[model samples]
Target chain A: MASWAPTVLASDTLIDANAVDYLIVGLYFAVVLGIGLMARRQVSDSVDFFLSGRSLPAWVTGLAFIAANLGAVEIMGMSASGAEFGLPTVHYFWVGAIPAMLFLGVVMMPFYYGSKVRSVPEFMYRRFGTGAHLVNSISFAVAQLLIAGINLYLLGTIIQALLGWPLLVALLVAAVVVLSYITLGGLSAAIYNEVLQFFVIVAALLPLTLIGLDRVGGWGGLTDKITEAAGDNPETAPAAQQLNSWPGNALSGFDSDLLSVVGIVFGLGFVLSFGYWTTNFVEVQRAMATDSISSARKTPIIGAFPKMFVPFITILPGMIAAVLVSEIADTKAGEQVAGGTGGTVTYNDSLLYLMRDLLPNGLLGVAIAGLLAAFMAGMAANISAFNTVFSYDLWQRYAVKDRDDDYYLKIGRLATVGATVIAVGTAYLATNFSNIMDYLQTLFGFFNAPLFATFILGMFWKRMTATAGWVGLVSGTLSAVAVAFLSEDAFGSLSLGVIPVGGQGAAFLAAGAAFVVDIVLSVVVSLVTRPKPVEELKGLVYSETPREDLVDADEASYPWYRRTLPLAGVALAMVVVLNVLF
Target chain B: MPTAPARATQRRHRAGALDIRNIIGGLLAAYGVILTLMGLLGDPETDKTGGVNANLWAGLAMLVVGLVFVAWAVLRPTYVPDGGAEDPSAD
Candidate 1:
């Protein structure tokens, strides 16, 4: 979309490099390596290597969770959004992410950590049967791989932007450095690094704010001047609007509301919140090897708190940049706002400018280190998770002999390397994706959406059979993927049946279709299909299990649905109130 | 019931979830607010070089001072820091 003008505005260029930058960044990296090396001693077995043997204190896991999820997109996207958009765009974090995560922590997490299952698909196998697990494992793994690749790609691009390094070399170095650490240290190393990243990342942002405030007109002045400049000018108002919001003018005519917003929030949130976090292989692996239910359960909730704030770190800056565009251009805010974006200006670049122009030396590097930490943590977490799942679930399931730790660990490392290569390669092809959020959301919707319905039914409804689980999973995934690619022209409209729709409409339609189809087929098949032997059902039923049991036997002690009724009522009220208010 | 990390690890596999001590939500809320306010209010340079605009010299100075308030509010560093789960075995 950009010609690049073959020119680097010194502002867009790497404006400064000094000892202060290196010192903070160097210290942050050293601490991570030190922690990684330290954690290596802890990684003697699969459980310890992958899940920290379920012993992580809540705070470390919490910060690590944030660090893992916080990637290049958050670093650039949030700031870029804040700098470009104004106030309302904060909804991306607050309105969309926060409430959902809170709901997950308060209501949903208890169910997950209580479940005591290692992965999402493992729960499906437990609840439904192996068939559903088989279908979803591949799709879900691919989706995670896509996330890993996209993140790897963003890291490489950021490297290129920061140092003018060749893209592939940067990608490989980052991937290898991180992979080596994770291979040696596993989840403990990842979390330890994440803990360090959390502090350094914040340290970086704090200074950027100071310099930007000091060097510019200060916070209030920046707002008043921009408001004054934009108030009188119609041409500047829209750009001001984009710079201040998520539905940016950068890509012209891109507007969305509840249908879109709900679709996105619940789509990304419920799927990952329930599917990946609760039942999936990668996220839940942390819970699996936890020493006890409290750490397993509490660690994730602790993690959720930071998850809610992460969007704040990056989204606001972009919104602010959008508001201050005219000031940056030495023109009336209106003039800069007038042209209105047509996908020409990459929003990611705007964030980098704010970082270059706004942040001071030491903090900038630390913030950059935060970006590096996120990339490393996310990839490391993904690799650790995927390799374990592949080795334990797939490889071991099919392999002839019981393999040695070295032999299996080697396989896991190879899986990590293979996945990393695929991911870096995938980044080059993300031109089709408009932005990181879009790419992340779209894939999550297609792959994870199916697991949600299947998992819910599998967990609660004892009648659900393996056949039904398989059918439900297949329907959910296939339908979501099919729907993602659909357009108005692809499906003819009907005034009596439906109106013309686009983007996520298809994804929802697919999910709905799958949900209904799964329900019907599961009922029919559960009745006709063979059921698990009664003794095997003992796990789902109570038989001397701990509280973290995914299916509690003492249904009467706390009839979950009955206890959850009040919470659901409150949730419905909030949604209705928000629906009205928004 | 002692609420120490040692007690926490002793019963890590016990009956309840990891309690966040009721303060995390507010911490997150404050974090969101500071970021939003800064984004809305920030405008350091009117010129490309990021020099303080003459008219806003006083306001800009106060804004820098105001950051002290933001720091005071946000950097309080989450009371009940680890939700009382500071166990060596849990690490």
Candidate 2:
């Protein structure tokens, strides 16, 4: 087990920053707060607060969709994965995220947009009744809080590392800044800031990646050095395994290459990815904010273009850090290094160490600002999604049935503040796990995998019943929890070690178990129960909805780029190219 | 009196003034300016980046992209119909 230590790094400060660096970070904060104020002018109602009034353009929502997912967990966790496992880490993006994103855009979005539901749980309520809806809403809210805490934790650590502030002070400051913007303008503030952050993040990381690559010669040089390093350390993965993306045993934590491939494809790619991109309200909310149904359909498809290339800037930097930074290199070589957010250094410090080793002052400021923006974007996405579900899905639906729109809007705002406060507490919970991905992937298995199973089965199979929905969800989640507890080190010391695999492989196993269990229970219970009537299933079920309602009739009149199919086609071809080349 | 299309175009221009592109452009340009100044006058610290002026190049790139966004917002602004239906089910 990786020893858990003091939450804050022992070192005084990781990155040295002068006044100019502070000025740049300050400018970024000013611009972010200014955007929040501007977006406040646009929010007058609950709908505006929750869904950007459903009036944003496709391109804006598309960028926000990717940015919301790009939060600090993605940046830090993926880099950590990259440093620990080599090229195989790209599967999380190219294989795991893109296809599922494209599927959300093309296959499921029509049902969501056409049905005119405010959130995913509302759709569940429509299809399967109150039981499934309540189950989904409560679970989703809890998951968002936990995930938000993870983002908050990373954000605080970055602040602590940069300014040498205590972790608690940094946490409070980060929480307040996020709470301020989200409370002021609601989802509009979050989305607009996300759009800005997307660019800032690119500006920050792109230079770091390029500079790191230059320092290590180039891509070929990186490969050669990695092979040499692997050769020197018998404890590390083979040079071939570190360099190749296929048969990812190191990433999956499986001894057999065949099991690793199966685990990644079925577990991570099919179940977990689909569960997240298709059903998670954080990403779906961005797509739902677009003006027209066609635009909504195109949002994730557009996001897919950038999603495929994210590995280069995110994961490749970790790969570079593993080679270039002496501390990261020593850690990877099975040697202990000191001075990180944890008392002892781990792979999570790869990106920070790289920035310290390279990057001059001006660029360092940009990088710091970028990391802050990413974490805020991540936490804001969680809080905003949590508020929407809390107000519209759980609190308003269950406790107060017939309130005014204004009352619900107030509730949404309160939920945002409440969730943020709760998140600060949860952030401490996140410090136990050194590698955030392990914590996160396990959560996805428990929440998203089973939810995806219930959603997909109910959406396509018209005969699925409401009783089946709630039953399947409860069982699937329990089974996943059981599997995680059984897996080695998945639950820290609580893990029973019955399942031999650990880390991401255990996550994949748990997700697969959840998906299978949910599907089986839903099918069995559905057979014995009475299904919803055909008359009420128009937009909710695939067979009942007319083809005409699923697509925009006017799309053909526009240019090819404006149509959903053509856009999705281009995205698919590009992702295929990325998968093949890398 | 203006033609219908002309009036529509004018309305679009009004919405365009409130476009997010302007904010993105303004901020990027502001950051770009500071970084560019730092690149010119402040310590280059070329040794850290293996003899590259990273700040100058990154700043210039930000400036160019920022201007492009501003130009796009001005040239082909988004068209949001006046008081469009806020409710999705109403359509």
Best by DockQ: 2
Best by lDDT: 2
Please state the error at residue A296 of candidate 2 in Å: 0.5
True contacts kept of 1: 0.02
DockQ agreement of candidate 2 with the native complex? 0.33
In model 1, where do residues sit more than 4 Å from their true spots? A1-6, A9-15, A78-117, A209-277, A325-344, A488-521, A539-582, B1-91
Q: Docking quality tier of candidate 2?
A: acceptable
The per-residue C-alpha lDDT of model 2 at residue B20 equals 75
Kindly list the per-residue Cα lDDT of model 2 for residues A1-582, writing each as its tens digit.
Answer: 122333434658877898888888888887778667766766768888998888888999999999998986679988988888889999998789999998998999999998999999999999999999999999999999999999999999999999899999999999999999999888988998899899989999999999999999999999999999999898888889888898989889899989999999999999989998899999999988888899999999999888888899999999999998887888988987778876578899999989888898988998999999999999999999999999999988899988889899999989999999999999999999878899999899999999999999999999999999999999999999999999997787889999899879999999999999999999999999999999999999999999999998888899999899898899888878877876
What TM-score number comes out for model 1?
A: 0.72
Please give, as one word, the docking class of candidate 1. incorrect
What is every candidate's alpha-carbon RMSD to the true fold?
9.5, 4.5
Count of backbone clashes, every candidate in sequence = 46, 0
lDDT by residue for model 1 (A428-525), tens:
76545544554564565556556767766665566667788787777666665555445331122311223244433443444454555666667787
- Looking at model 1, residue A402 earns an lDDT score of 85
